[model samples]
Target chain A: MTAQPDQRITISVDAMGGDKGPATVISGMAKSAEKNPELGYILHGPEDELREMIARRRGGQMLLDRISFRDARDVVTMEDKPSHVVRHGKGTSMWSTLESVRLGEAHGAVSCGNTGALMALSMMRLRKLPGVTRPAIAILWPSRNPQGFNVMLDVGADVRADATDLLQFALMGASYARNGLDLPRPRIGLLNVGTEEHKGRSELKKAHEMIESFADRANFEFVGFVEGGDIPGNRTDVIITDGFTGNVAIKTGEGTASLIGDLLREAFRYSPLSRIASVLALTSLKRLQKRIDPRRVNGGVFLGLNGTVVKSHGGADDTGVSAAIKLAFQLAKSDFSEKLAARVASTVELAQDEVHFASATQEKQEGS
Target chain B: MTAQPDQRITISVDAMGGDKGPATVISGMAKSAEKNPELGYILHGPEDELREMIARRRGGQMLLDRISFRDARDVVTMEDKPSHVVRHGKGTSMWSTLESVRLGEAHGAVSCGNTGALMALSMMRLRKLPGVTRPAIAILWPSRNPQGFNVMLDVGADVRADATDLLQFALMGASYARNGLDLPRPRIGLLNVGTEEHKGRSELKKAHEMIESFADRANFEFVGFVEGGDIPGNRTDVIITDGFTGNVAIKTGEGTASLIGDLLREAFRYSPLSRIASVLALTSLKRLQKRIDPRRVNGGVFLGLNGTVVKSHGGADDTGVSAAIKLAFQLAKSDFSEKLAARVASTVELAQDEVHFASATQEKQEGS
Candidate 1:
């Protein structure tokens, strides 16, 4: 079953969910296929439209040969609620895309649909792995680390996560760093308002003790507490926080970057001399852009689930979509989902032991 | 007593608190005094050092004439806990600084010390204004708005904020915007993961409804919910959230900006041609830097207190301290604390009525 050298690793793509529709998704697939010969697609959409769009392309036949179409009649809109989608989205491309992964027909799934709906459908179809309470969405942030990026988790999966959930995120995030970024024992840090031990919420304090107790057993270094400024700093390789804080931090970073970019553009256009200088500095500026380009690290991988799912930006263009597909391909090739599940399963007993020990200690302190 | 024709608005300065020491604080005061002839200072520190530093300056006589000294034997270190400071910090310069404001000896107080200690001392000394449960720290963020900055509150005053606290932050933030940014009708937005009504925590949803209901009475346009990206965008003049989220967001923004600045510097130094180009674009880059300079917006005003207290950055230099002093001078001259108190007092009854109405509606819905 595994010996066909010419057979490419397949990625299930919800072709109808993005802002630019099926054309951009197909163009992205084509772009990825050209770049990586080992990649193929399980295209989910209305079969006729998708086939027609692919057939109209320059390398249509080659793309058509590698791609297989699944006829999904319905499309999930950006406005669709997660509950509504889970209840009635079976005929949608997003549902079909995850179905391919669930049925083992594709290695991983990719979608640019509504994030909530995508996560909901993913949880429903693939289900959580044993001992996993809440699945998290992990994304890569450009950083001063030697690896050039740091992994941050619980980006926007849920608005709440308790101390136990944060512990799980730390375990899962460290695993992702190992598999995705090739770090053997990634250093993890809990995000707080300050680096001081006395700062942040009570739950953070609990999580800190729990994470520290398990760091040696888990085979990752736990750097006690990290402030938001340390997210892009070189002190740690993985940042663990609740979804609400992580989501806001990432978006704030994006907004600030966008503002700086706009200001840089305005600066270049300010005067004739500056405009002339822009020409000479074009190469240098492009180098900087490439280093921090959001598209290059475009996917948010849904972790702690039975299957791997990458959620691309809703308004993603072809290049952005291509980056997401590339991420999916890498995860699928590495069997990331299975490895992550194994990591969580192996540590469940240790996690439970820590929780019980913590309560017992609290009880003793109160009794005293 | 009314100020005489030659008399100036006086500010209480915690001269010994910042990382740069009392010399930088005095330099900042002198700089502010040079530009503002109608400004004076009540400098708090050891009398001998203060006099020596002032006498060593170029315009020492003029600075000496405008300054008065208060002898304080102790200093609040950055590592001191708020509780410890509250108990044993009576002899510190920070305490002396707030004392001037409490005794009506100065119009406002400014400190460049530990934020938590300053806040604890401020609450203990200045006291919370009537009807205020939790005081907030509001800072200005560079933005696309006409005013060039947006006001965000509860940046790090306290870690938690309930729905009621959020409503108060909204009122206080809007008041700050009106006085700080001169926006007669500031547009306020609740910070959340998404703009959708159904998104975010239950507290955010409750705050959203409460803010909306009070918008007309509060004289602000409620923009409903705004994501983190809108914090710097022109869409909202005030972004309201709990202290934990706001603190993380602002720090993340700063970290991202610092990363881009470093990258830009590296880009300019990449090659000889790029270096030459940087020389030509120097003026344009400086213009951009000036627009988003953190030094220009260097103070976090503690709102919901009996008197004005501006917290400058702990690591602020002379220019940064000067900017903070300028902010304090402006707030003191405009009688911002009194105006804000009046605004809060006027809306207290309305707030109580809305809270009652909300609970009644909830009870009715639950019964149905």
Candidate 2:
């Protein structure tokens, strides 16, 4: 788990979990292998099928040498309930993928399966970190920041989060940003309906005070409250909210992006002159697409767990899967999971002290 | 306030409430006057300033003939708290604007003011409809629907909504879509984090059942639960949620759109060839911009109230203000408030009956 330059970082892959099947997964692995020499893989699925798919690739022999296979008989479908999967998914590729991480055979796990099921199995196998009540799913959003992305957490890990849970998210999110994005001191903002002190639900106001109280000790700057508009804006490095709001916000962002993309395509096909202009502007447009492409920011890292798990998009192609792999490699290289755990553990103690202090202050006030 | 072909529709204007000065409001009124000969305005602000601005327009004399002035010396700034404004804001233009509607002097009102203040002032002045506990702010989102937009409600009206409040929102939203958008039977969907039955908060689950129970009687098709993406998607015509989630989703959508637009402009300005292409694509690009322009969908109608109030964006310029005026005119002409009141009143009785029946059923089960 040490970040030694010469240490090999192996990623556990659930090859059969994706919509595009194992070929795309194998191709993504090959792409990752071509870029990094210190990377290895533990491909989880039916061993023979994965072996044949890897052997048929362009640099099949080299890829075969770096990849080891684990035979898993079952494939977790998108429709399978997370609870059902947890009880009966022991033989699945997703389970085996997390098992590799749990057994210390791989540094991290990547799965392009049902998100709910993946999180369920992940929690079942890896368990929650000490004092982590709700594990968060953090994703990188394309932003106008210097790092070119902002991290948002609890994007559908659990539908609810209390004041203390939100404080935990702020600490964990700051840690992820620091290690994963190379920011030494990240600015964290609690997401609310308005930036005003009196707005939003009462939990947000309580969480705001809790997060601010621990900001200095946690090595992150508290930017106070931010709105949904600031999620992709350059105002903050880490945006923290309960899973319900974060999930809706990110999906709404994606839906808006997709709608605009569709509209742009329709505009280009409006006339022959516009079509010609599209051809002329193809390179610039491609550059723009590359900059804002969801594929480039593919992984949703599951934080506050014993091990790291990167949930790739269910419909991800090779390019998308490769992006997830790159993220997993970066996180593993930085030992992000361990760092996040340590950050959360220390903050939990701080949070408890603050709670006790607050009640004691109230008691003194009452006595007076 | 019956819809009559020859009756002139007057919209009360809060001239000093917007980020821009009274000049922008006067210009917007002039634009509306130019388009519709039957539209009149009760301009609320310092009388002399509004008069001078109107007189300075191109068709000064003609415009002045249809406009009336209300002298309110104070202005409500964005920083003003809603509670403070409601208690001490009698002399403000925002209060005067709603006063016109309350006194039946104007058919509807439009203000580009602080949203919280507007809604608070509105509830206090106009009052809520019978059996309506929480009034909602419904806005039109640019979408793929045949009508070109979707209606989402409770977009920061209040921070919270219980199951019954959500049911009222569903009924009110359906009425807005039917009368405002000219849809006879609209489709209503409750917004949640996911489309699954057991995915969101317990209140959402309760709201789902309550909403479904009244769909047929309310004259709208219940599309069940919808995610954040469906806010702008074609699956539903009206999206209903608590103010907190709806507020975040819309702002997130707007932020994502703004980010893509800035990136697109940067791409087009990248090189000389791209600049040439931008020139050629000007018409098409403008067409695209016009299609999704936020100004075109500028008004957020405060539903579940006795009178209709359209809250324009605080930063709205002349075009945006004009759009708000246009919506106010449409709703006034259609007697949208009357129709919505009728819809909610009947649904309220039905809801009471359902409650009684449910209790009766439980009694019968206990007896058995």
Candidate 3:
């Protein structure tokens, strides 16, 4: 269940995870393995497909030992039922890959596929932390703040949640800040309708009180409510929210940024003069575009669970898949789970009692 | 209260209705008036502030006869409580300006100060459409769909709403679409967790069914449920939700869009090589940027009320204020309210009956 300080980290990848399946994943893994000598990769998917893909991208037999393959058949689609994905697809590529992490055959798992199914399967297999009713997906966004990255949690794992769930997400995100990203103490801000206490919905208002009251347990600076503008503005190191809003906000941010980039490209293509100018400025513009490319931060960590899981972009190609594998390896090599567990365990005894008390109090208030 | 088809619609600008008060509002009004000569303007803020600002901007008093001033002692602040602004500030610029619309002195009233207070006063004075419960604030966003502008209602007006309230928002949005925006039969989509029948919170689920079953009475297309991204991507013309989610989504989109624009500029500024290219690309980039500028589409129309009240940007300066004034005048000249009323009247009886029947059916289901 634990790794020694000098032990090499192993990662299990669902090679058949993305749109291009094992071929693109193996190509990326082969390239990454050459770069990271100490890293080990377990490619879990159909035997023939994994072997064929690996052979196509192989540098030779010398690099072949760095990867080992396992057979897994079923593939979960975006339209698949979450329950069905978790129940019927136990022997599937995604499920077997996640099980490797749970069984400690791998330090972490990476899947570039259906987000909902992955979350459900991971939760069912690895189980949620003791005080955690529902886990959250935490993403580190490159921020303008003094901190290089701001960790935002509950991206899409749980849609409707209570105050306790939000508190748990904050705890998990703070742990991630320290262990995964190596921040001293992440400054956490709850996403709200406004900065004021009187802002946001009744649920958020209630969650704010719990976050403030239990501030020390999470071991992060509770910086109060942050607005949507504050996310990209880099005013805070961590933003916490319910899954629905968080998912929408993240997707919107991604979509808008892409739209702007496309618009800029079109703008440079407008006229002959503009095109010539764009060609002249291409170097500077390219640097600028690279600064916010989501591909640079290609994976979201599914936090507050038993083991680390990195969810890559469903449409990611070889380069993006490589980035995700690198990220997952980095997470596994770090003291992520230990630090996360200590943070969660620090307040474990009273976590459930507090949650119950808060929920009861809220229910009484609403009922009255 | 309708103008002749050939009559030129007039709008009165509360030339003191923004953060900077009269100087900026007047400047904006003057610019908008110059752009559209057929649109008559009546400036109703402090006379001296308007005169000084207009003179400074080299605007001639050519339209002096068309403009009028109604002096008010106080102006609302962005920080002021909505209730306090409504109760104590009877003679405030916002109240007096809205009075002009109520009494038909102007077809529409534009105010950049105290959006909540403006909406409240409009509701109190102009009154709601006979069968409507809660009025909503509808803002149009540019979309990729070839069909129509995306209308997100309850942007920040009603904080808490029931199933019936959302249903009313749907009707109001559809009416506004058909009459004001000139969509023959607007398609209404409920913003929910998913497109599934059982998706989203219980309240949204009930509202979805009510909307679907009420298709007999509702003139618009009820396209079932839609996810958040669908709202801004131009998938649906009319998106209905309670104020909480709608406000969050709109703010997220606006802030994120602006943030991306800022990042894009920063991207181009990264190096001298790109700077030259950016210069060549400037004109086309500017054209595209204008297409998504927060300032150009800053005005939000408050719908379902008896009169048209346009809410301007809280932080609006002269140019943004001017854009809001122009938008308000255009909507007023269009006589949005009369059009909305006629549209709502034809479907009111059917909508009301469906709503009652829905609640009863829901209660029976819940009991079982």
Candidate 4:
């Protein structure tokens, strides 16, 4: 469909979501709007404060035309209980953003607020897409392929998951790969300790069997099991796992990048001669650093929700906030949610039929 | 406690470990010996190949009194099954190295071979330390702390674990911190989904209660739950988790470092002007990189073992091998096994008695 003259994809951004808060979130949205003409935004926070930020950015005209305001008197602190905050603190920018999605006023909601709160409220308010029991937070991870951006799901939504949840995550992650990244037949792998068909925890094995049963009809290529190290190896385009494992992996990866950056700094400071040699090698070093900067891949889209929920890093700065807004716009414009809902509904139908067939076959075998 | 004239600690080194095996292992040992006089080594591999490498370094006669040799016929490939290769290939360098530890010729074995094999062989040969149902490989992670390393255990040994295993890991890790890092009283934390005591998988809650039960003993500080991000936060000295989680975290960290290094290289390749800015910032970046290089902190001591079992990174170079050897020496001279065995044995005794007393008290209450 061509762009609707008046029906813009209005995104509600949690202005007080990250470490940088309203200032950086507003700045990022302003920068993002400079490049995308069709994107519109609604700043969800204290109205006066958000307006001040917009005025400072010289975005008064855009604010008047495309941007509006949603006043949230309360802000969710990092330590606030997710359930309580989402329940009692209805005025929080995070809750307000999700409210916009629920009210059909925005195409998506983006926030760098308390992760647990965003997840809790999004699931509580927007509800999961039909046939998806648990919605996953999907992030594009650094991969070995030069152009690779491997999609990983369930980063921190549902910690204790079953085989069915894993399969749902796979379907959702595949939809993201197809609809968000615009790829055909994204290679999907079940994240496990080993690649063998029989390897991995019992839940993973059951999930594997379910995925295998639907191999013919599933949207993505089932590439079997993948190990922890393979996430960065870029061997598969989409990786599926429970939220607990994915969250740990993502945080570990971030911590490691910070550690390596620290190490490189120490290596270059060995001696005056060594420092000079490092300076000479700066051209090559910077080439590598920019390719894997966390800032470039800072947002995780909460998939399978009725509307999009974008999660920026808890430690996001202005640059990262900008990237998150751009990411949210891309997801909104791509209209991946509708496509994801359809794909999930079809997959669940196929999985249920397989379950029924298996039971029937077992009964027949017993009768014989 | 002075070096007993006859109480020597011989550690077997795998000459054929990693991509650069014999050359790097040999050079690393040479470098290690130059720094530690009390350390002795028994390099195992093909006689001709090892001698050729040793000759290139110094033509022999240097540290000959401190080092010896053992010959093995084959090498373990990365893809080899730990169980089959360890059981069937006794004459291989990997097995021979473990054999030295088993035969009491060495206090510990250091290998950059497949980690799975080393962990399997160590358990099968030396047996688990008293009350340690399963052994864990503990890595001394480079921290932002100026003091030294953060100890993380079960770095890919046990895939599935119970609360009991976590308790055992915490005790073993505490021993390492107290003896290895010389922490008088180590701060211990359970790696969980969140810092909240109840915010993790069911097993985490049980583990938390168990750790708290021992808080009165005052052997170590029970810092309760720590999230995955806490590993790099430098908040606790010892972080304990199951092998699957630890392994994934460690590998994710390594892969992230590699990815960041790649990104930095790309940032500098944009243009000459950018290259100059990279040069100006090169010193700080180099310092950061060296602070987290896997080579500098390569050796991960497999704790909860009758004897020291140092599991080197499979992709370790010479520097890594040397670091493993050095760690082996420190572990050996420190008489870690005796301390570890005593602590485990005592902990088990305490736990058993506590259980028995609790059951008896419950019976009396029921009778009343």
For residues B120-187, write the lDDT of model 2, one tens digit per residue. Answer: 99999999999899999999998889999999998999889999899999999999999889999999
| lDDT, candidate 1, A129-169, per-residue tens | 89899999999999989999999999999999999899999
lDDT per residue for candidate 3 within A175-285, as digits (tens), equals 788776777877888887678777667778888888787777666788889887777766678888878777767765665666666666777777889888777877766
lDDT of 3 by residue, B201-270 (tens): 7888888877777655667889888777676566678988878677777776776777566766776787
For candidate 3, what is the TM-score? 0.91
Q: How would you order the candidates by lDDT, starting with the best? A: 1, 2, 4, 3
Instruction: For residues B100-128, write the lDDT of model 1, one tens digit per residue.
Output: 99998998889999999999999999999
Q: Per-residue lDDT tens digits of candidate 2, residues A208-244?
A: 9989988899999999999999988999999999999
Residue pairs in collision within model 1 = none
Could you list the chain B TM-scores for each candidate? 0.95, 0.97, 0.90, 0.92
Candidate 4, residues A1-368, lDDT tens digits: the string is 21244567778888885876677777777777777777788878898877776776675666556787889888988788887976787878888888888887888888988888888888889988889788888998878854567888888887867988888888788788887677888888888866766555788889998876666697578988888878887778888888888888888787766666666756667777657756676666655665677787889999887888888987787678778877877777777777788788888787689789999999999999
Steric clash pairs (candidate 3) = A281-B277, A284-B274, A288-B267
Instruction: Identify the candidate with maximal TM-score.
Output: 2
Candidate 3: regions farther than 4 A off: A60-63, A349-368, B6-8, B42-44, B47-57, B147-149, B179-181, B193-198, B213-223, B352-368
